[model samples]
Target chain A: MIAAAEPIEPAPSAGAPIDEAEALRRLRQNEDQSAQYYAAWWLGRMRSRNPEAITLLCQALGQRQPRQAEAGVEHNAVARNAARALGKLGQAEAIPHLLQALDDPDDGLREAAARSLGELRAMEAVPVLCTRLASGPDVAGAPQTASSRLQEPCEAMLEALGEIGLAEPRLLAVIESFVAHERPLIRSAACRALLQLTDDSHWGQQLLALLEHPQLQVRRAALMDLGAAGWRPALEPIRRTLAENSLKLMALRGLVENPAGPHATRLDEETTALLAVMDELL
Target chain B: MLSPNPMAAEPTELIRALRQADSPMGLLLATRQLAEACHPGAAPSLVEVLGFNNPGAAVAAVDGLIALGEQAVEPLLANLDDHNYGARAWAVRALAGIGDVRGLELLESALACDIGPSVRRAAARGLGQLRLDALPRSEQTRLRQRCLDALLAGGGDGEWVVRYAVAVGLEQLLLGMDRAEPGHRSGLKALQELAGEPGDDTPVVRLRAGLALSRLAGGAGG
Candidate 1:
């Protein structure tokens, strides 16, 4: 008979398993570029609230190492990912540093910073972001080779504004113009933003129409967009979308419920309607 | 009546350590040791350690209280300190982890609006796993609906982690409910929504909700 295998330990994560202390050390010391990058992701992923971790991440926002693959571009992947982590760490202290990063020459880092500020819901960053958005997606330093989405932080800026909820009519008008942008990605993202900013079903209708677009990727993105829009009319369209169960269910729920709202002891009308729709799927 | 046990009167190592503890480090050491001795006698000291303002010691104390199971619920309740937010947070977590239905009201309140994400997450997970069978048959349905309501409300929690925990709680609540009930239909619909696209921004939340929905289906198949 074959010998029974002994159970030892669970497999390690894709990134090497480093304890909190080690992650902090690697991040603070800039042990190596690779080590530093992984450490930044880890500290944020682990939700480490260490003041030292926050300070190191903030410092990393300015570590401008040029991308070797694209030698001419001075964008730092390390700083970009570091900005992403700081947002996840939920420290308000990083907000000022992130705002400073918003004006960085590297649009990639700027995008990451915008995303983090949105995640932080930095209300203060709104006017700054609006100014940047007003400047348009084609900033002066952007590389011509990359697509509009990759070349600028416009898409990310709009998404962040939506996350923070834009009330300024000037910024809203800028986002509204992007609804007619040539790129499908930008157009879809604009619709999502408009929905959040305006809470208008017109944006939701545009999102539903995008759900029927030729590309599968655009449809998927619209499904997510519609979900975040929380427009009541999007529910039926989301259910009918040719997507997997996970996406369908998520979009439907967002239409009826706002996660940040007060505790629900009883089912509201929207929730009742949601259940009625779900009954058909069941 | 059953005969009383003399062993209950003997001082366990946890109590002895608590008496000997003179410093913060000593208290942590005592609390850590209490993890080894999971007895009803250690419950009070474990509850006391929650107010130590030491996360390490407090974590150990919470684990010890949880390990004491249903027995620790009373002391945790009686010692509820309204003034100390940290202690209350830790205590709420411990009570939720214990899943002894007696912690229902606390779990509901914590899930509703506790400032600490971790506390709310614990409450969400705790509310779902309450031992409904422990209640009288006549009362089980009402209690189950109460749990379902809290978990459903928790589904809207802003923090993805709390919402993820809410998915877990909902799945557990679903497991306890009969498939034909109106509550089960609403609860299951909420789970489906959590699993849906753009429903939760975090992939982890969506994945967990999807996994929860899958588990419920698998359980039904069995």
Candidate 2:
């Protein structure tokens, strides 16, 4: 499905990369939450497919230890990071555990699980994502504090659905509802879902129009969504947008690199136009 | 209650050029003109063109029939070619697009097992958007339930497109409902299950279903 949401990598691995044995060793030593978190991030960032590494992360996903509670919100960074690691590991075995994490009480873990599910392109996660979205405050008349629902995984879930593509009309109906959302980011995400569902230029144009939004978050969201959509038609519009040039270049690279794969440096017409645009950005 | 094989007789001389046309361009030209004629005489020749083995001409003929609306339904039903799968599929598309109540049975069975995913998809969508406003409110309610039942059953279709179409049809059917009515909840519940059907692997279907859910969730009735 148009290459699962451009695997957003975790922040550059803490210090240098570690050997698999060392990474596994750090992940197992749960006495220090910081070490375990970095190790989890490292395992995923390094794309470690080792069975033991996967098993450790799957186990970590269930251990919501070292809860970082603030303002009545509880989060286990290690478990959240572990969920992210498992998604990058690319194993069918992690799917069941990820689905379980989806129901975890920790909002952070659920968001992480949703992101990973999209990265893994787990089709089974669609219903779980739908259920989560359906039950969220975004539902009409649901008791809502913008801040509380903002922390929810609606964006990740929407991105996951977009990566998964249209499976059911009911699921699609849910996505369509976000178009009229009071928040711009959610609306941007809905447009991304539509692009993946239909690959139509109309959605690309919808995202492009978001560039005019007064909010930077909404504009940035549109830029990123446009990149994830890989809408070649948006290349020129991205250039014309008032955002920072670096952001424009990054979005362009995402569109060009994604379709042809990272190793594709061929000098085709599309690439030549991209090079020209890149030159202008520079 | 319609003539058997409406195309069996000589196609009226009105479309003599269409009958004589052998080249693709010639056929297309003839068909395009006849499709735009808006004359009752054009209906019979258009029905006859369904079997002509030219897709472009057949598309034009279908458009002509759809333009003729209810007047063309009987002729379309009568001219159904049991031997021509292509023609039959096209007929289903025409009937679906026409939204004639007379095509209801055909639409139901087609959605159930039309062999062609495209045909089933068309039937599923057609069933959802079928015009029932002219019927008495009680009749509309009964027929809507029937339409909902068919859509829910079609949701399990093995082909993702058909399943996706079923989701779309369900959305259309639900949106048209009077929320205060007794059946709206059942329809909404059906849509909720569709969005998250266990073991459903097709994301496109799920995506459409989620959109349907979101749209409903926003409304007072939802």
Candidate 3:
């Protein structure tokens, strides 16, 4: 059996500050702490959006902590934080390291990587994110089991991809695939992303199909996406969902955002029906 | 039937690379499903997860254990003191699912002292679940008082889910009281007021209140 990871050893003690030259020398020497702190400081600088900062951060990311996987310097928080900060910097240069960190045994480290990939809008990270979608939480080998620490960052990447926009064919396929993702969060994330990218494309049909998703919450997400995308074709599903008494009011609200068309008359009917039950809330 | 080593052919992959899973996330996904499949045998895994610092994993483990029934009692009780409020609260709910008398007194004690309103409500609920079977009639009075205290303490929760759980738990305890007794007469009235209050109108709360009211009606009519 390929057992799960052994406990990681702590990194070396905090040391005196080193100059960029000294840090570069230490990194080459395989001293974990020197490289780790240098990397963290570099990534932090990168997030500042200054040209000099971006250069420094990119340099840190390019350098490898070869000892990271070898000497088991896995508990190197500074090194891990640096990797995360690089991801957040959103530079295309950071993609490889960020992708590498996604496999981190540490949940926080993996998420930081995920977020960085998302923030940078690293389109190359899409394949990795897509793989994460399929991993589900079940696989022991996957970092989905790492910790709660990664959940938000993983979700963040999906959300970012949605807001970043995608082109046709591939965009529709990604949306269609994610609609079937086992995790509700991922499915919803994919739906939201698809909605953001919808235009003359056939995304309206995909969103309509998602309305029948097994998870009612996913259906709600699809409804919201359609409403936001102005996919007028979705009015029927949205209206149908709003009419169901057991469904949440938020879903109903999402469907009736426009309050016009078939929606105009249906909204009144649904409101009248819900009013009797939601009177106090209204 | 699924094989025990579902992902045997696939090597474990890195978390970051899970996106391009060599076996298509097969190994990672197999492990999660395997946890659920471990079912009757997964008790130990779930118990061990209670100590995990990761709230997500702990929550998953607890949910698995709760699904396993009475066998999860000892380990869950040990986790009642978990550092995370969510873990402790989930533990309390799992204990309620067990609904054993051994946990009744512990839950009652928890109501008076637990820091988080969610945990307090969960403990109160554990007591409520045990109401018909374990609680001695003499202890019922104190249970009523402690539950009401929790309702008052948990009144202003930012997460309406917690307040709703507390409200429903309060109502359950109230309904269980000996309404025929003059001292218990006002308990039902308090529950009725709390049930209709706008604060408890969330779908989750409304569902709980609906269930609680149904129980109360059954008690009154029976």
Candidate 4:
């Protein structure tokens, strides 16, 4: 027994285990700004399933630190990183924090929050996101940064609502209201959101009608949405649009999105001709 | 004066205003609004504005055209020969993003022979976007092999930026390949060699190579 003196158990290492708590601490309060960024990135990269990581990320989402200039662009790295981490984590618990972050002063942070909300598919955020889509920044006293002036947050909000895909009547109504918004970009975003909201043939038909919209942008958006939604009824219309040389590429894309092989019998002479042309061009 | 809050206007009303814009400045401003609107119907207007002298308006127009997807491809192709380098640059970029085979020929040519680094860079990225996965397996292998060869050749490009683009293109090609396919091994071998080479290769190229290698080894399809 003495000869085989028990191999001494390895001494408990003095180095603190690099665990979630430590990562969270570094992400939250690390003096080295780069370390903070790295920590936030690492948490998402590792796909840490820990609840505390979610909580820390949510808390960090609201934090507005001194603006850092990155590649000549001013932004809050911490909030941006935190919002991105939360989106990657896809934790439901982080939704409220992300929703709150939609109103953050920094446009980048707001965009990041809106994007994260979409990632979580937080249907509850639809109303708030719609409001953000309909209105620019809500804070009266906040300084208008370049991003706010550019209305980037509005784009982010619209995209978020689309990604949520609640398709609730209220949400659809809100999005529909924006379809008529003056900004073609916003209108385009609205079309995308509507397509996301419903697979209804009726909705598809409605989008088809927009193919004749006077603005090329509107027609373009309709073609894109119809294709994305795979609205089979629109195939004929898209084929008709494809007859126009300028619009042919888009219409062909729509037709391709809903291939006619399954419904070959339904193809009219014109559609068949257009399909042949599409085969050549595509 | 253009209304300060264009967001409040209806889509139809906004289109009317964009059409009615009298001066280049006014058209530029309205075009900026339409670009932000993200509607494909704006493609024609945006494409027209792509020829505008104002850098900001041209930039916005380029973005809108790119956003319009295939709708912008033909129009952008029509403008590919525009005298303005900026217009050509933006048109190439939009066409490249659309990734149609129509754009593929020009992009491949540009990546292989363009005098301008920016054009080469855009072409490289455009090559990566060409949905090889959608093609038949034989076509996929053939096209990917061609692309991989082009990218490897581009790795020796004079500009680090172009080399970086090559790395990105290689990653895209590797991603679209079926792991079980024999073609994948060659693509993997190229990326691994690039990753292993530290001399002269920029950090970005090396990083992308390492990532592509890891993705391939991990059996994660791009």
Candidate 5:
């Protein structure tokens, strides 16, 4: 897999430079939220592999002190930053601590933990993540806002499962249950997880069948899965959907994925049209 | 043969709910799911939702389109002429963020001509994100030079935001070029000049320019 681009690091000023020791010191002792936040950010930006840096970050990850919330959202700034830093550090040693953080009361911390665990590919955390998925929203402590649904832990859990790339039978069963979920997001996530777990061309056939599903979300999910799997069976169905303007972008993607496979000779007209677009665009 | 497979019908049921969704919130929710799925098919709908009045939904749509990668590029190009300028601007942004060479000319033209600050800003950033490495060495050098020239020419752009973008684009191009070569110094020199321009350049532009200059000086780019 292609590594994601590294973030641009801010340049250090000409004044007295703060070394890793100082950054660790500030992260450990700083009372100010903003100062500690910057410290955590810099540690990750520097991609510090130091054992001490990892320890300090883990400590920060477990810190529960309340800090200034960013405008509308309330979250543990230190823990969130630490989780992010740990992921960038790409240290497997940080996995256990991140797994512990998955149970953090703050949803944001839990979300960050789940993401880092995925980045680390901590397969051991899969069972716990599945449990979290089975459990519904932690409504009592969750942010009581309309947007909470969008920020739920369930989304992160699904994403982590996909990233881990484990397709255990129990996990597959759980994911399968959600494929027809009433919520489009969950259903879509379920489809993504299924693709990650199953290699059977049967699932690809099922996804192709879903191209005719009434819900736009399901159709979109099927298209996405087909593209990821490079399912050639989807080529014709994807081509047909391009007639619907709303589905064109996704259909084009499906075509891109299926291009010049065994079905190439059969898709002359479609391929010609697609190549025309590419030629025009390129 | 008599009993229908409940497993097979689940997708159809989900699709029904999505189509029947009544509220803006419902539509937004569905859009978010499709985006999260990274479904290329969601690109058109996501692009359509860019014209929606809801800021949250629009932002989600823009992000979703970007996350779809190269799949979203052609559709975004098609939407460049969207009747709604807001949607058109966002299409420009999604294409820019994807940084596919297919949209390079569109972005270049937008930076050179678009009246909206946001559109021009996105275009400038897009130019920086171009995958010059995919081209042959000669083409890479030629394209990098063209990008540098365009950014330098736009340094005097009236909008502070555009200038800030140009500084960033210059930094990106210079960093992407092979620093061992002698021509790389010219790009670095341009960045230094921008950083030193105290009066006309805003603090942010100057800050970016100075950062780029420092990075190049450190031999960070090879």
Candidate 6:
């Protein structure tokens, strides 16, 4: 009995265990630069874990930075992280601050904002993402210390909206425009996003047409999407493009998944033939 | 030959280990092996690894990030400026494999600055693989020039495989240009003459001369 001493109570879960109000107050008043940074970050993280905290952060994000504003609020890694947290939280209220962040001169800040807008799945941000995509990567200012990678966040944002399966007309229009962007990578991303959105009618046909995109990647993505949609029309054209082993493998895989028996058999034959070529090359 | 099946008896252990792996390489190898076997559970862990501390480890985490292919692009792109050329090269190669072009501009930059000729060559091949040649003439020229310069720099002593690669790239550049421009004309002619006598002297010289011929032919065609 003595050895069995009462079991200790389990520690509180990380979620909402402490006094949120107290923490927020402390976070608001902490004068230490790093402390303020951590506070803002935790606030954002907490907001992400619980939607209730979103409105509060939204208001705080909207408030003008203190007199040290030029020091750059969002550039603070914490602020950037917070913006990303808000993006994950997906509250519409965070849109404006996130958009303002898009204009922030800091590439990191702008990127964080772009990523958050995407995670929120806010279709309203579609126009902004499109504009940025069109602008391409920021190559000016600050001796260009940063690489062109900041543009990936906006690309992610675009993908997020597509993956959310939102059917907003403007969103679709923006996605369509991206498909033709001067940046091949952006166009490829747009194609992938469009694939995420499978509208059996219009979107499906457009994706099917992309089978002919000059870029093999766009074509591969389109074929994959068509397969995902179980579109039968993809069989013939996909069969024709079997020149590429990778693409052919994808087309064959799609046929196997979707079940066009005769078409699948044909693909199997082509696949086998392609394997012979590949084996010889290998 | 490891398997990827999640329903296997040791699946739970593997999954747990995957979540805690310290290095991305370990995580990637385990996940890839698990995937080959039959386990789909490695996906999330793989995706999580993309956010790892080391850029190389982060890149190793990519093949398993299909759940967020597009989502992973930016993180991967950000790594292109990594202090270690290997890390930057790995990131560029991975983005190209992801083949989304979201990082094409970044890759284009890498083709110019990254130290190793192999890395630059990979970037060039990736652009061609992605058909970025179809981009505007200006962008195309930039990409082509980088590829040409890299092919020429790689040297003829490397390997026939490398030599063949340089020749292919020279051909690609010749085929990619507007053909009417003076630059294109000079480049194609230089490439054709180089390709004429395939006897390997210095791979760099042969490649460079071949690339010039290709550009010359391209310009003449235009």
* Model 2 per-residue lDDT tens digits across residues A1-282: 122111323443364657889889989987876778888888897789789998999999977665545522236878988998988888989999999999887777887898898888899999888876764435631334655455456777788888876558888777777777677777788888888787767777889889777555566688888878777778877876645443554577567655422335344556556645653332
**A1-282, model 4: which lDDT tens digit per residue?**
001111121222222335666777787785665556656766875579988788777776665567645533236776788888888897888887887887776777887888778878898888777665544333321235653244546555666786776777876776677666555555555665676666545555566666666554566556665554444567667655412222333445345434322443223444444444432221
Using Cα atoms, each model's DockQ against the true complex is 0.02, 0.01, 0.02, 0.03, 0.04, 0.01
In the order shown, the candidates' Cα RMSDs to the true structure are: 20.0, 21.4, 15.5, 17.7, 16.0, 27.0
lDDT tens per residue, model 6, B141-186: 6656655555455323233323433454555555655666445554
Q: Rank the candidates by TM-score, best first.
A: 1, 2, 5, 4, 3, 6
DockQ score for model 6: 0.01
Query: How close is candidate 3 at the interface, in terms of C-alpha RMSD after superposing the true interface residues?
Result: 14.9
Label model 6 with its docking quality class.
Answer: incorrect
Cα lDDT for residue B87, candidate 2: 67
User: Clash pairs of candidate 5?
Assistant: A214-B15, A215-B15, A250-B40, A250-B41
Question: Candidate 5 or 6, higher DockQ?
Answer: 5
Q: Top model by lDDT, which number? A: 1
Q: How high is each candidate's interface RMSD, in Å?
A: 16.5, 19.9, 14.9, 22.7, 17.0, 20.1
Per-residue alpha-carbon lDDT of model 2 for B1-222, expressed as tens digits?
A: 122233344335548888888886688679877777655567778888877766557767777887877778888888877776556666777787678889989889988977656567668878887888899999998888888888888988867657767777887888888887677887777667766756246443554566667667774212
Model 3 ranges off by over 4 Å = A1-282, B1-44, B51-71, B101-121, B131-135, B181-186, B195-222
lDDT of 1 by residue, A120-197 (tens): 989989988887766554442243474533555677888888889857788888787778766666788888888787
Top TM-score prediction, candidate number: 1
Better of 1 and 4 by TM-score: 1
- State the number of backbone clashes in model 2: 40
Q: Native contacts recovered, in order, as a fraction for each?
A: 0.00, 0.00, 0.00, 0.00, 0.00, 0.00
Tell me, by DockQ, which candidate is best: 5
Candidate 3 per-residue C-alpha lDDT over A123-156 given as tens digits, one digit per residue, 9 for 90 to 100: 7767666665544433422233545333334445
lDDT of 5 at A169: 84
Error of 3 at B101 (Å): 4.4
